[model samples]
Target: MFAFYDLETTGTSPAFDQPLQFAAILTDNDLNEAERVDIRCRLAPHILPAPWALAVTGISPDQLVDPDLPSWFEFSHQISDLIKRWAPATWAGYNTLAFDEEFLRQSFYQNLHPNLYQTQFANNDRLDLMKVIYAVRDREPDALKWPLDDLGRESFKLDRLAPENGFANHDAHDALGDVEATIHIASVIRKHAPAVWDQCLLNRDKHEVDRLLQSGHPVCLIERFGAAQPRSYFGVFAGTNPQNNNSVAFLDLDLCDASIIDANDQDLAKAVAASPKLIRTIAINKAPNVFPVANPRSAHGSLAQLVSAHPEFHQRVGQALANRYADKEPAQHVEQLIYDRFYNAGDKRVLEDFEVADWRDRAQIVAQLDDLRLKQLGMRLIFSNAPEFAPKKYRSAASAAIRDRWLTKEPSTPWTTKAIVEKQLHEIVCGEVLNMDQICALQDFYHARISEIDI
Candidate 1:
């Protein structure tokens, strides 16, 4: 089973923004639809929608706070129940691994569920179609209809790709419309390039990845970035480095490109950290975003070429990796546990107890937590679910910052005021940014809007 999901949110910042709508499509192994869910909730009082986001999504404050809509708590519970029912299945989406996944995790946390279980369970895994699309383009460019932006760069945005590729996307920003487009795109890939699709699906299994990494051979890696397109490279599983217990680092074959490979150990150590080459590291317990290099010839030549060409390549890479973080300060306890994937039995009970506790009891529970990581995490939960209950003395600087940001008021833009509109019109006439006829039309529209205002 594969669960394809999408979210429409108030803004881009996952830490501060909240979801307004959610859509999910459940399909069998072959991409046949089995179930679909579309949900919307009344906007929480604490959330303020961004103006640009509102323009793109076309969801007004009036619409979001409609009395007929479900409450956020009820809506989140429904989403949690649906995901739990479909557990032990692969969760696939375009650009979701980085964006939607975080939103969903935060939602679960705010709702008081074990936040990370959906994506972290042994039987569950994740696949990002955006990454898969990058891989497909590398192998077979003609397999799918690719879109290019105005600058002629390849584009992977769902809205643009949908209409170009013959998928219906009537509601471009609607959660359900995006979900349909994702499913359609997945189906097209499976039909045109079965090999790419199959391997991507196969790699979702953690055990398969473990076996491949344990082989100590070179493999193609596809990594996604939140701000840019996906990048692929040839790398080897450079077993656990000095990062953490579950840390896994990849040795980039390109790092041996004559510079560091020939340098002495001392120089190599500093060079590796400074090198622009990517040394991909991930948590071993988490689902890997990389796939096996399908065609060794086209990728980074043969594995033998990477090995024998530089005899000391392996040793040099190890030296660089070992010294990379030798003197760096460690992460905070809460962040370290998140990186280490160290949730245990006690933590589970703590989460359950924290969720159901009243504000006073919740504060008491947070105070009593012995584990520094759990205590920090518990304070965050308190701030999210019961902010009024959080003790002033225990609140961290970071927590205070988030609270300040969420409560801060934004001033209205100049374009929204009549005084600014008249000034802008004068500037436009004098500056010649627009013609006289265009300025006249704009003034006419402004007057008409003003006349229609109830005030």
Candidate 2:
């Protein structure tokens, strides 16, 4: 059995406030409501929600000031009784995994009924519908209409969807009225969209199960483009995050929520190790792309510095840089120049693969990077891949370049590469297939010249 639930709160913190109103819809197989409940209550000292909460929910303080105030504690008891009687496998709400369950648990704790959090009652029995829609369904922006009070978004806005679906929400702050709206929408979706229904149920324990199946499990492999961008949470998607959050990592590991488990949680560590997607935050530029030229470049600081240090490859790097000036060229000329200057210092394979214009732009960046590298000041990173390659800061020029190359939405040339790199072109391509974002990463990777940091 599954329960579709919604709660309106007097405040954001469940630890501080009780539900002003709530709705729960019980369903078995189809839209046939095995059971449904909607409850509202007047405010009291125990549930003295802050003034801001009342204003946000649009529920009047006068509404709860009545002498015949409803007892929410008793109402919560009714809910516990229903759960005991029904023994539902799961209950779902939009963002319920993150927001609702925490609020409910806090309410239970404050009311001296802490065990209400456990499913059967045990821990982690609630499903989050918001995650379900994102993982399985296409996240096209315009799919939804603008909501009354807020901008309509695909990920976490229940208000955005409710109005379009016919159960328009009047207040974000009222728990019972919110419930009435929640249950109505859940009922409508269960009757109409079974795919989203099943997806909501499955997301209670797993993330991206359906989308993974649909795409044959394509993981977003990362490569950083510039130094200013830091390792973002998006790094979690590919593997263990690069952010200095808990300060623990192994030779291999998986990535999960830092807030949910301890750093020493070996079980969680093992789980990460066993996964195929080795999530790791990658730097785009040589160093963090700290703007304003105050910092030294990390990837390829300067040709003069590099040449002065190595001295032997000076002629070759100069030649590669000069190739940018060449009007028309053979693939060999490009390869030879890359071999001379950028071969050992950074991954300059992209220079050999990009169109003339991009190649020229890269040469300029490379020259700039070499200057930074010469100074040995690295760029700063801001973002990490949490199942997606989100950089700390996306350099507009580089991002546009990447988007154009992979999305192919703009005019571009079929940039040719040297012979050795293209060998076995027809072989079945291994490594997980690239996502739209990952494809951009590949383009960024080829173009970016960065020295691998050994940490």
Candidate maximizing lDDT: 1
**Residue 273 lDDT in candidate 2:** 39
Candidate 1 lDDT over residue span 251-287, tens digit each: 6776644343356766655545554644556554445
| Candidate 2 local lDDT, 173-289, one digit each (tens) | 445445445565556655555554554454344233323212212222212222221121212112212232112111111233332222333443334334442222222211111
TM-score list, all predictions: 0.72, 0.41
- Summed backbone clashes in each candidate are 0, 68
- lDDT of all predictions, in order shown? 0.66, 0.39
Give Cα distance to truth, residue 388, candidate 1, Å.
9.4
Q: What is the lDDT of residue 379 in candidate 2?
A: 17
Which stretches of candidate 2 lie above 4 Å from their native place? 44-48, 70-72, 119-124, 136-156, 165-200, 205-455
